[model samples]
Target: MAGKRGGTAAKERLSRDVIVASALALADAEGLDALTIRRLATDHGVTPMALYWHFKDKDLLLDGVVERVLEGVEIPSYPAGSQPEWHVRLLDCFAALLNALNEHREVADLVHRRFLGSTAGLDIAEFAFAALQEGGFGRTERAEIGVQALHNLVVLVTMEPGERALRDSEEEVARRIREKKVVLQSLAPERYPNIIDCAESLVDKPADEGRYRGLGLDILIEGIRARAARQLAEPAEKAS
Candidate 1:
């Protein structure tokens, strides 16, 4: 009987976590689009039906991969009355998330697409919300800012340059930036004054790009701090 049903027997050595790990490796090497069940089954020396025993559907399989990747992310403990401000703590969390996602470029898209449903995603949301609440933001404001924070994370990982983009030599990067600057500066200043005025910055490698996670998070935290202060002071203006 065991020999008759060879398909299941072939997958006897595979576990759910093993399958998810294999899928994650495949995605890391060749993007998420290449992570199909049939491909994974072949990789694992099993049949598609064997994978079904572990993950009922494709979505479930991807969910497992997401969870596995997220498990590597480190969420720091921000105790009450901590020395660092809440916004700082939030930045730390965001930095950790960016670094974790940076390691797996293929999963960055998946994280952005389905983050709200993942356990690590909710953990990050809860942490940020607590920080916002502590910062004196109202419930509605917290929700709005939370959405923005999540969006920023998605943009940071997906849009920012990855290992592949940075694989070029330093000379190549500088040459590319110089060409971009000249092109931007060559545009008719009469028609586009702003572009001409900021041409140097527009294509400045160090100033305009690179380390997007830090740059973007700095801007976001500053904006949130300013908004939180204004929101806190609104009641005082009304009373006075």
Candidate 2:
């Protein structure tokens, strides 16, 4: 029995992929706070140095985990020549990303804590930049829009319900929605006329989780379109 156990231990070699995947599983099973090099070593039946061989420190390890989560997401690709408007294309991308983030709550939280400068993150950013350029945004404006879209996506995902409530009991979900509506409706109408007037819309039944996000993106796109039109007119005006 001792020899058999020793053989099994000897076979348990570590690789960078295995380490990163284990880290991701750990983060998903427990919260991010529980993820530590020591804990990882224990989980893998290895020494702390074994983990260090793959990741120099916690931050690097986290970056790897984040990249692993992001790898599951696909950036939306628009067809050449006859693509939708830039904002539509942009929304398509954001919608896909938001879906991906929502699927992994822990990963979304991690992404919220650390800016994703990973290769996958850069690729998504490049895609957004191209969309913005197609929309006629200046370099600075494109950068701002890309950053804000990501920020908005993170906020939307983070603020959503803790778990996948689609499979949850309707009674429980309805109770929670009613409670939220009561609080919003009870706010002093004098101070919050808009909130008071739009309570139903604010907390719609069978909640449209993407309602606010869609509306916000619409506003952003419209604003960008207006700005782009103004910029074009200004150049023509100067030429005239």
Candidate 3:
């Protein structure tokens, strides 16, 4: 059988991971729409039928995008005895995941839509459990909860809202802000005092639209830190 070729008969030399990597590269270079089994077959030097043996269809291929996005990254497990720094590790995990998401410019939209279902995401959750263990959490679920909170942070930082609106580049945001100045000035100062006061700041406060994302990340991490402290104190309250 065709399936048997890469399995028992061929000694399983080729790998699913390699196939996924090739697809990811295609999405990176030519945009996600350009990717097809035939294109991947040409890029990978594999027969079309061979590609099917791995992904079957473009839908499965997209799921492969999530797999490749996470690839080899593993969450740090519970440390024995001494406590592992919780905030640093959690931030590192988000940084790693966000960095990977930023690499595939084209397929990022697809990944944003559905990546939490993958095993790699689950491993990240497990790593969170390890952090909770350091914070005096006894059950595995507390760690999972910590990871989930951090995951929300990463998603907010990385995922652009709505079809990106094309004019999404930092420069584009500035252009829009400048263009909105007339509208801002039209408002009565007495009627909308706060808008009048912050109007100049609104038309590109820190400039460089990308900096907005960096600022948002700081806010998100701060929120996560506050939440972690609350979670830690909760257990103490229960015990008392």
Scored by CA lDDT, what does every candidate get?
A: 0.78, 0.74, 0.64
Candidate 2, residue 78: the lDDT equals 54
Global fold similarity of model 1 (TM-score): 0.80
Model 3: weakest 10-residue lDDT segment is 158-167
The positional error of residue 99 in candidate 3, measured at the CA in angstroms, is: 2.0
- Give residue 172's error in model 2 in angstroms: 13
Over 4 Å off, model 2: 1-12, 78-82, 112-116, 161-186, 193-206, 210-213, 236-240
Which runs of model 3 end up more than 4 angstroms from their true locations? 1-18, 38-48, 72-83, 109-119, 136-214, 231-240
Candidate 1 residues lying further than 4 Å off, grouped into runs, are 4-9, 78-83, 161-185, 193-210
- Top candidate on lDDT is 1
Total clashes in model 2, counting residue pairs 3 or more apart in sequence or in different chains: 0
The positional error of residue 40 in candidate 3, measured at the CA in angstroms, is 3.1
Kindly list the per-residue Cα lDDT of model 1 for residues 1-240, writing each as its tens digit.
Answer: 876568656667778888999999998888788989999988877779889988899999998888877777798785677657888877787778777787886787677557667788788778878888899987998888877776787677666532233346777877887788888889998899998898776555333334656788899889999987898899999999
**RMSD, model 2, all Cα superposed?**
4.7
* lDDT score at residue 70, model 1, on the 0-100 scale: 75
Model 1 C-alpha lDDT versus the unseen true structure: 0.78
Which is the better candidate, 1 or 2, if ranked by lDDT?
A: 1
Q: Candidate 1, after superposition: displacement of residue 27 in Å?
A: 1.4
TM-scores of the candidates are 0.80, 0.72, 0.61
Better of 1 and 2 by TM-score: 1
